[model samples]
Target chain A: MIRFDDVHKSFGPKKVLRGMTLEVPKGESMVIIGGSGTGKSVALKCVLGLIRPDSGTITVEGGEGRDRDAFLARFGMLFQGGALFDSLPVWQNVAFRLLRGSLKRPRDEAKAIAVEKLRRVGLKPDVADLFPAELSGGMQKRVGLARAICADPEIIFFDEPTTGLDPIMAGVINELIREIVTEMGATAMTITHDMTSVRAIADRVAMLHDGVIQWTGPVGQMDTSGDPYLDQFIHGRAEGPIEAVR
Target chain B: MTGVLTGILGGIGATVLGLLAMIGRVTIFLGQTLSHMVRPPFYPREFGSALLTIGWLSLPVVGLTAIFTGGALALQIYAGGSRFDAEAVVPQIVAIGMVRELGPVLVGLMIAARVTSSIAAEIATMKVTEQIDALVTLSTHPMKYLTVPRVLAALITVPVLVGVGDVIGILGGYQVATGQLGFNPAAYLKNTIDFLEPLDVISSLVKGAVFGVIAALMGCYSGMNSGRGAQGVGRATKSAVEAAAVMILAANFLLTGVFFSL
Candidate 1:
């Protein structure tokens, strides 16, 4: 479980998150939907401490302060671009955490876990030895997904999980994410503007607009929410509360 | 005239402030790197890889630069000494010049161009791709995983590379003087060996280590703080090499003054 209380973040003259507050309960897949530059990524980064919120408290599992190493270990992230280490082979990228630091395991054991995770993400075992550059875009996303779930994290964050993938591949990723979250019973938070992904993966939907959550409800309620911003975003209309021109 | 004076003064003031801020940031970065050296999670594998990249792979370029410079120095010294009827001094001058100044300085500059740029570009690209953030999420410190290894490798191996460069440079001078400059092989060898002092070699190595730290630190600093996108990476790489070269030259001047002023 996570909660952001009055999170306000700004970059110089640009205020990205203004008095924004939201929550994701345990074992729920919460997908945040927003148009470009609406601070969706910024909000997620704030919780992860990649970007510090100017004024706010983000509490995870009921505590505002936790050991950074231990706190980060409880969660995994799939970056927008997959963010695989190009210097490393696919297996090493998946086994990165286990190959070093406090979570280190034997090389063979870590490789085994990496292979298993790759399989879970619909990747062949042979794909484990190739470099990230050698993989297709969809394969890279799946590899990112595999790496994210490698540690069996209690929570997982997916940032634009299906961005840059074809519709069919995007659907495959969405399905994989849904299956993983359900099977692992992990709390999930994904950010994207892909309505197709939303329908496939989200248990609950929250629409971000003007640095605040404009609408939050079950996935089924998303269609009839009637909030102009949410309706405009989900419908992909050029004219509405969210103007095409900033 | 008054407006021009004000404009120039304001520009100078802003430049000075910008320089001070940069220095402050670099000092803090160095302090963080040093502190992490003593912390847990030491990464020997990364350090080893850095050694190969920064040290072993750098041999060809460093060797070529040193050899050519040494040969050129030999020819100039012979020509200059001939005018004074002191052509015999070629070996002594070449030995001192290569071992004391040219060897370390040339090697340092070469590393700046080669190793520093590579490190900056690689790290900057990694940052652009968000691999750095991934490292953080995986419970790893990016500084430990990335910066510390490269810095440590440079500190440990640049001196060794300098030593190798010095020998190769002296060989270059020997080849030119004996094979082409009409100097006797045995006599030139004896002169070079006798003219060198232990302090000269020590100073050269010390300069190598210091220059190594500067080059690698500048690379890592520029990289870690790089802006987003491809252009950001390009800028970080260019600035890193430029800063490393300037710092190496400056540090060399100060170090020379310290070592020889006595």
Candidate 2:
């Protein structure tokens, strides 16, 4: 479980997150929907301590002290671009967390786990030996997913998981994400503007606007949420309370 | 005229401030790297690969640069010495020049071009693609995982490369002096051996080590601080080589003053 309490972050003159407040309960898939540059990524990064909040508190599982290495061990992130280590083979990339530092296992065991995780993500064993550059976009996304779940982390963050994929591939990834979160019983936090992905992956939906959650409810109730910002966002209307670039 | 002068002063001030900031950042980064070098979680595999890339693989370019520079120095010394009826000084001058200055300096520059540029480009690309963030998320210290191995490898191996370059360079001069310049082979070899002091060899190796640190640090620093996108990578690579070259030459000058003048 993660909690953000009145988080405020600013980059010089540009105020990205004025006061963002949200709480994600354990074992729930919480998807944050927001337009580009709404500080969605920034908020997620704040939780990971990648970007520190100017004023406020973020606690993971009720622990306020940021023991960086130990803290990071509990969570995995799937970056928008997959962010695979290009120098490494796919298997090594998947087993990166297990190959070094505190979680290090023997090389053989790490490779085996990587292969198994690859299989879980619907990748073949043979694909493990190939480099990321050799893989297709969708395949690379799957590999990224495999890596995120390889350590069986307690929590996973998906940042634009289906951004550059085809609709079918996006659906596949969404489904995979949904299945993985359910199977692992892992707390999931995802940020995306894709309505279809929202429907497919989210157990609960939170709409972010102007650096705060404007609306949040169960997935079934997202349609009827009467908040103007949420309504404008979900309906994809150019003319609404949420400004369409003047 | 008054406004333009103020603008000029402002630009100069900004440039100076930027330079100072960069220097501060590099100093902090270097301190972190040195501290991490002695600490735990050492990645010998990364160190080994870096040694191969920065040290062993640099042999060809270093060799070529040293050999050609040595040969050219011999010809120049011979031609210049003839004016003073001292053409016999070719071997002695070439030996001192190559061992004391040319070998280390040229090899260092070659590293700046080949190794520094490559490192900056690679790491900058990694940053751009969010691989660095991924590394952090995976509970790895990016500085320890990336910078320490490279700086250590360069620190250990550049001196060895310099020693090799010195020997090869002297051989190149010997070939030119005896084979082409009509000097007696035995006399050329004897003169080279007798003229060079142990201090000259030590200074060369020391310069090589210092230059190695500058080269690797500049590359890593530029890459780590690089902005986003392809243009950022290109700029980082360019600035890394430029910084490395300038720092090597500057360090060489100070080192030469310390070794010889002091």
Candidate 3:
């Protein structure tokens, strides 16, 4: 389980996260939904220790201050734009963790595992030799997915996973995320504004607003949650509490 | 008068604060990078790549610049010496100028233009794309994976490059003087060989190493602290080249003062 307790983060005069508190139970898929620039990404980054909170404690699996390297090894993340290493071939990117540090494996074995993961993510074994620039957007996303799951981490983070894909490709990625999360039984936390992605991948939904959780419940109860901000956001209305101009 | 005074004070204060902040940040970054250098999980592959990029590939530019500058210096020195009936001093002056100053300074500036900008742009793009963050997530330190190897390679290789530059520069002068100016090749070579001292060569190599460190350090520092987007990468690259050039020149002056004054 991962928990954020009264997390507050600010950059200069701009307050990004103001006392945000949330919880992700073990083996659950929690999708955070919010309008643009509402600190959804900041919240996720805070948990990952990519961004430190000003005056809050984030406890991961009952430890507030675990060893960073060890803690990071347990989690895998898919960035918004894939974030593949442009200099490396696809297979090298996937097998990066396996090729170095305490988790080092034989080069051949690591390459074989990378190929397997690539296949699992709907890419051909031959695609492993190509650089990230050679692949299409959908293929690059799949490659990013393969790299993320290559380590078989206990926790997975998907940041704007289906943001730039076509609807069909988005659906395919959604299905892939669902299948992977279910099969791996990893605690998945995804942040997306796409309703289709939410419906396909989320067990529970949390709406972030004004640097706090405005509404949170099981996916089925989101429509009838009786919160105006939630209703305005889900229905994609330009009016109500959230000013469209800002 | 009061308003003008306030404005001047505000500008001066802001500049001082900015300088201090930048100094503090660079110092901290240097400490972190040096600390990572002594720790485990060194990447030999990355180090080898850096050595090739900073050392071997830089030879062509360094050679071209040194040769042309040396030839031009010989012509200028010969012309100037004729005014005082000291035309025979061309070989000695050309050799000392190439070995003691021009060779190292020109090579350092070339490195700032080429290697420093390239390093900054590459790392800044990686940062913009979140590859640096991804490296952290993969249990790799960016300083170790990126900065240390490049810095170490620069420290190891730039002195050798300076030595090569010095020799090529002297040979260029020799070619110009013997072939064009009707000078005896053997006598010119002997004059150049006799004029150059061990101290001059040692100072040149030391300057080369210092310039290399400054260039690589500025590149890495600008890159790791880049802002965001394409504009950020461009700014980082520009700032890195500027800083490296300035620092190299400043270091050269200081090193010269220290070495020659003694």
Top DockQ hit: 2
TM-score of chain B of 1: 0.98
Q: DockQ score of candidate 3?
A: 0.80
Task: Give interface RMSD for all predictions.
Answer: 0.7, 0.7, 0.9
Residue B169 error, candidate 2, Å? 1.1
Q: Which residue ranges in model 1 land beyond 4 Å of their true spot?
A: A62-66
Model 3's CAPRI class?
Answer: medium
Q: Per-prediction DockQ, in order?
A: 0.89, 0.90, 0.80
Stretches > 4 Å off in candidate 2: A62-66
Q: Give each model's whole-structure lDDT.
A: 0.93, 0.93, 0.92
TM-score of chain B of 3: 0.97
| CAPRI level of candidate 2 | high
lDDT for model 3: 0.92
lDDT of 3 at B35: 92
| lDDT tens digits, residue span B34-80, model 1 | 99988988999999999999999999998898889889989999999
Candidate 1 interface RMSD, angstroms, 1 decimal: 0.7
lDDT of 2 by residue, A1-246 (tens): 888889999999998898889889899999999999999999988988778899998878946365667778889899999999998999999999999988999999999999999999999999999999999999999999999999999999999999999999999999999999999999999999999999999989998899888888999999887888888899899988888886
- Tell me each candidate's TM-score: 0.99, 0.99, 0.98
